[model samples]
Target: MPATYNTDGAEDPDLYAQLMTERYGPLRLILAERNRPAPPRQARANLTPDPRAAEHRHQLLEALNNRPQPDPEPAA
Candidate 1:
């Protein structure tokens, strides 16, 4: 979906405010208004170390080593 922004060059105002309020109802609108940054991406650990902090390190390595399954076809 395309992001909306004010054409009038205003920085502090939300361009999608009215539409978001109508679409998601009021509480979501309030939460959206808070304008928080998105959460950070998760990091993976190096599994080659002798003393592994994770007990399931081998399982994790095995899962990573396996080939990824193909994505399912989209609905018609």
Candidate 2:
């Protein structure tokens, strides 16, 4: 974006005015002079849990309750 002011130390209102006029045109300007707030963010819930989800949760709870185990032996 260009600097909002000119080098001569004047606010470049004319540049933005021209840009808005060209981009939106005068009719749109007359209809709505201001912007509206953006739509709210939407969140979707997980519809179905995985079949193995319960088993995985149980395993996690058991691991948390028990003493820390050594790393498993690497595969051959």
| Model 2 pairs whose backbones collide | none
Q: Give the TM-score of each candidate.
A: 0.19, 0.30
The lowest-lDDT stretch of 10 consecutive residues in candidate 1 is 1-10
Q: What number of clashing residue pairs does each candidate have, in the order they appear?
A: 0, 0
lDDT of 1 by residue, 1-76 (tens): 1244332554535645555556666654456776777788758776567665475787788888896978999999
Clashing pairs in 1: none
How many backbone clashes can be found in candidate 1? Answer: 0
Give the Cα-based TM-score of candidate 2 against the true structure: 0.30
Off by over 4 Å in 2: 1-43, 68-76
Superposed model 1: Cα runs more than 4 Å off: 1-22, 26-35, 42-44, 52-76
lDDT of 2 by residue, 1-76 (tens): 2323222443676776676667667644444544555678757777877999999999999989897779999999
Write down the RMSD of candidate 2 (Cα, Å).
12.0
Per-residue error at 60 for model 2, in Å? 0.7
On lDDT, the candidate that comes out on top is 2
Taking every candidate in turn, the Cα RMSD to the unseen true structure, in Å, is: 13.5, 12.0
